[model samples]
Target: MFELTRYDGRRRIRGSIYLSIGLSLLAAMVIWVYPSFEAEVDLDQLLAAYPEPILQVMGVRTMASLGGFLSFELYTFGWIILLGLYLAYATAGTIADDVDRGRMDVVLAMPISRSRVVGERFAAMAVPIVGANLLPPIVVYVGARLIGHPIGAADVLAVHLLSIPYLFACAGIGLFASVIFDRAAIAQRVALGVTFALFLSESLLTGTDAEAIGAIAPMRYYDPNAVLIDGSYDLVGAGILLAMTVSFLVAAQLWFQRIDIS
Candidate 1:
């Protein structure tokens, strides 16, 4: 069981780290290339064009805002897409892959109970997300600090931490989907599709009565600007993220037990 856990976790961590490496490098490059941290032209004018309620929900205040940019640009309200993609790939196929690829029979011959097997495997899948949540900021921070901008470390680290809830939310969604379907492909699609819809809907409803859609997107609650630039952390939203992870994990266990796995 321990071995399986390590195996699963390593696979997930490696793949996610590789995927995020290029993006993190590019972000660091751009941050260094810019003469000023702030964008050109008057950001205030662009900010004024936006609706007040939407701005409040997004926790955005200025045009040259790092908070708004992290939530809006890096996460793009589509962070769920990447998060789900990683989770779906890592988890949706865990059990299905073992069975389809003829590893399940061999594993069952070991001393592990069914529940332990499922639990360990699920844990393995989470390792990658933890790595995903951790690594990129290191790359970005190292680059930023090398350019004589010590604060870039805090900037990248903050936004990446803000992503904690977003990424775990995606992982949970995938875990639940993994328990729901028999096929890895179907599970992946279900998890990714649900996450995509949640975030995409929130973005589309940015300034309307439907703006409440954002509350459903865990990514929306994280104001990267406050943490990254303003240096303030969101304890309340962080609590929600932790709670959501627990909930999804519980749901995955329940459903996995209720269903049959061959």
Candidate 2:
């Protein structure tokens, strides 16, 4: 299991490091520009001008502070969409690529059980996701302090910490897609499509009577703007996100175990 996990981890480490650096730099840039926005316009008014759906989708409530700005500019789109999409794409190839290349047959011929194989590969998928989540908060926090708009350390930590479960859930979705499809390209496309669709569903359904439907989407439980800006921590929401992650992973494991890899 450790060897399998390490194999997957090694495959992803270089790309994960590059992605982490890029995202951290973006977070820093967003934080560094907060003072310019504060000096130039009424952030509350600017953000309020957008429609509720747009605001909800963008995760922009109030840009009146550093936390809010970072939440809107960095965390919402950058973390949720860009990073989430990357993780999903990467995970979608975890099993499908090996299977498609005939590498899975060699592995299955060994002593490893199908469940352990799937679980270890899933663990490999998680290495990059967790690394991607870690560096941004430090960058955001240090940048905020450097610019004289010090966001609370706890708030920054909470935002990044809570994001782990959300990203994990997204990866789980991709993992399911990976096992369901034999081709990596098809699995990637399916994972990306489903992940983005869920995000849109959660965003667009915010105020409707059908909002209950959005509960199925993972983003419904993740509110970086509320957590980072308003210091609101939703333990129930975090729990739900974690539950979804486990459910998706378990489903993927069972499917992989039962399906014909040929």
Candidate 3:
């Protein structure tokens, strides 16, 4: 049923593996340095010296413990910010690049409809999203054990699982951009900018009068600190993210169906 999805997904697997390995190495490094950093530095004084707004924006609830440190260092910065932006950037090229290269015309000439093409192309983004999420948790978990601050497996699992919907929503934004722009470069830049702006909106608007506006941002729902540090899983937030993902995909499909690709 998803022939194009399979085709594109297979093409992405190697790149995804490389991304996973790189992230795993990063997770290892973060874990490796935590003990030395904690022993050498005064975490409480350091956190106290930081301004309130900066801590709020960084989502640094606590840094005295391993879970808290990883939540702030690895999950929040790496998973939420970096991975979200990467997915949006990668998926931004899906359709627009095809159109720019004259490949969309050939693909459209096949039996598939425009909606299916958009849907399948966006679906293929799971390759990198899933790959990046899957291996890093294992690395983080084992690394934490090696460092003697073993984190909970359930909490680690929850953090990665909850991130999936958030990452997919980011990809959906890229898919929407991919359908709107005919040029791959323009689409990719737009997607990256928009995704980052939404992240900023969510991070900067917290507890402010304009916090309501940040609700639309995917980052508002994905709280790695809640899961990893507090052991609290926000299933409702994940559901909302999944709904947003579907909405973006549907929006892209509808838009792609109306556009004149010729």
Candidate 4:
């Protein structure tokens, strides 16, 4: 069933390795610097000086401990926004790039059904998505211990595990874009724009009368700070993200099946 998935998945291995190394390095750097940052700065006062809205937007509820510090300075920015946008941007190109380069015709000429093609290609996104999530937590745990500010092992694990669905949801947005637009450039741009806009809307609109408007955003479901700092895991949110990812993939498959990919 996943023949094309296996073929396409092999191509992403190197990119996945590179992504894992990059994230691990970033995690090491963030963890290494936390002690120095805590020693030099009055984190509470710094946070107080910042506007409340800005703090809320950044998900910086607390910066008092290593867990809180890493949550605010590392995972919230690096994982939630940066990684999410990256997957969205990368997945945006998967199908549309092939179509734009005249490769889709060759792909369609094969015996595979269009829905299977879409499903398998979208399935291949797991290579990078899972790769990026797998190693960073190990780095984070080891780094925190080396820095003498060891965090809860479960918390670190929970945050990474929960992020998978959130990231797939982000990639799902890109998959939808890839099918809707034959031009890779436009698909990528639109995916990035929509993903980022959802982020902004989720961050800026929380607690306001229009907060519900951001409900569709995957960011609404994933809360790194809540997990890392407070040891709070929202399984319900993860399930919602999983559902959203499935919806996007199914929608893309249906759309691709109906469209003329000429």
Candidate 5:
């Protein structure tokens, strides 16, 4: 059995702090500024400006108001950076770095299985990840409450909930790459490349020609704005993401079992 997080005595405390600060800044941007109170922008015009087909690709839908501020708006940025790319770099590097730094042999000889080792690494990285993902909505909630424009509790929760599956998918994929590749950089690029491609495929699925096929991508688990602003959760979409996350996690465990420590 394995948990992806544990406290090593020489923990990277600074690394975690940096992640928190970055997430805080992102929350400030999404909840406090731009569409919240600063810009007072129109939703319809923004939607109309972007082509209908293009809208589907970005995981955005017509919210008609600040409702657009919910799921999709946060996702528009979070998915690309937080979900799609960041964890890939973070997770893929952990084990591979151990191997490169001549620490893999030492760690593997401990009273632990390979699966547990990889899982612990993932959990450690996930500390900041969950923190980063959870911050935006928290910021939105606080700012909205303070500014007298409170977003619903459900709506705020939906954003964080919706993000988990998306982020976990990338996490699993990164674990796969980390086990397969020897170099962190290579694992990261491959992980990012594949995940982004899947995201785009999910995006491009908006068209009739590709719609039939693009649904295969895990990105379909979200309709960002709908869940973010309307408090609507796509049950089927969440189920699909959960399945993918589990599948990826299982795969990572099985795959890492065969990894050679020598």
Candidate 6:
């Protein structure tokens, strides 16, 4: 099981490293610009020009300081949309690519049970997600300190720590799609589309008559802005996200175990 996890994790390390570096740089850039915004713009007034719904969607409840700015501009969209899409894209190929290329047959013929294969592969998918989530907070923290903004350690920690379950849930959805589709590209597209659609639905449906519909989305529970800016960490929401992650992975495992890999 460890070997299987290692093998799959090694395959994804290069891409994961690149993604982490890119996100770190982006965080630094966002942090670097905070002083300029403070010097030039009245953030409250600037944010007030936008509609309330637009502000909510953008995760901009407050922009008075660096934590608020980083939460609004960097973590909310970058972590949610870009990181979510990347994880889905990466996990979508975990099984589908192997099956599509006839590699799954080789893997299955190794005396391993189908359950172990699926479970270990999904475990491997977590490497990149965890790696991608870690580096950005360090960059954001360092950058904030350098600029003298010095965001609260707890707030910075909360934003990245809570993100783990959110990304896992997104990847679990991709894993499910990967098992359903034989073609890697098709699986990836479906995963990406569904991930984005969930986010869109959450953004559009929240605070409406059908807000419960949006509650089905993982994004509905994740609010980096709330964690970082308002200092509000939703432990229950994190638990729900984690529960959804497990549910999706269990569904993928069960389905993959019963399916004919050949």
Give the Å error, residue 125, model 6.
Answer: 1.8
Off by more than 4 A, model 4: none
* Residue range 1-262, candidate 2, lDDT tens digits: 4789998899888888888899998987887778888999999999778887788777677889777888888888888898788778888998899898989999989999888887888888777888887788888888888889888899889998888888988998899999999999999999999999999988888889989999999888888888886799988988998899889889988999899978
Which residue pairs clash in candidate 3? none
**Of 2 and 3, the candidate ranking higher by lDDT:** 3
Can you give the lDDT of residue 79 in candidate 4? 83
TM-score (C-alpha) between model 5 and the true structure: 0.83
Supply the TM-score for candidate 1.
0.77
**How does residue 60 of candidate 3 score in lDDT?**
90
| TM-scores for every predicted model | 0.77, 0.96, 0.98, 0.97, 0.83, 0.95
Q: How large an RMSD does model 3 have?
A: 0.9
Instruction: For residues 52-154, write the lDDT of model 5, one tens digit per residue.
Output: 7777666666545445654455557665545567766667777767776678888777889887887777666656556666556667778767756677878
- Candidate 3 minimal-lDDT segment of 10 residues: 223-232
Q: Per-residue lDDT for 1-262 in model 4, tens only?
A: 7988998899999999999999899899988888888999998888999999899788788887888888888888888888899899899998999999999999998999888888899899899989998889999999989989888889999999999999999999999999999999999999999999998899999999999999999999999888887789999999999999999999999999899877
**lDDT by residue for model 6 over 173-217, one digit each (tens)?**
898999999899999999999999998889888788998998889
Model 3 misses residue 117 by how many Å?
0.4
Which of the two, 3 or 5, has more lDDT?
Answer: 3
Model 1 stretches with alpha carbons more than 4 Å out: 36-71, 77-80, 100-102, 142-155, 204-214
Off by over 4 Å in 3: none
Order the candidates by lDDT, highest first — what do you get? 3, 4, 6, 2, 5, 1
Candidate 2: residue 34 Cα off by (Å):
1.2
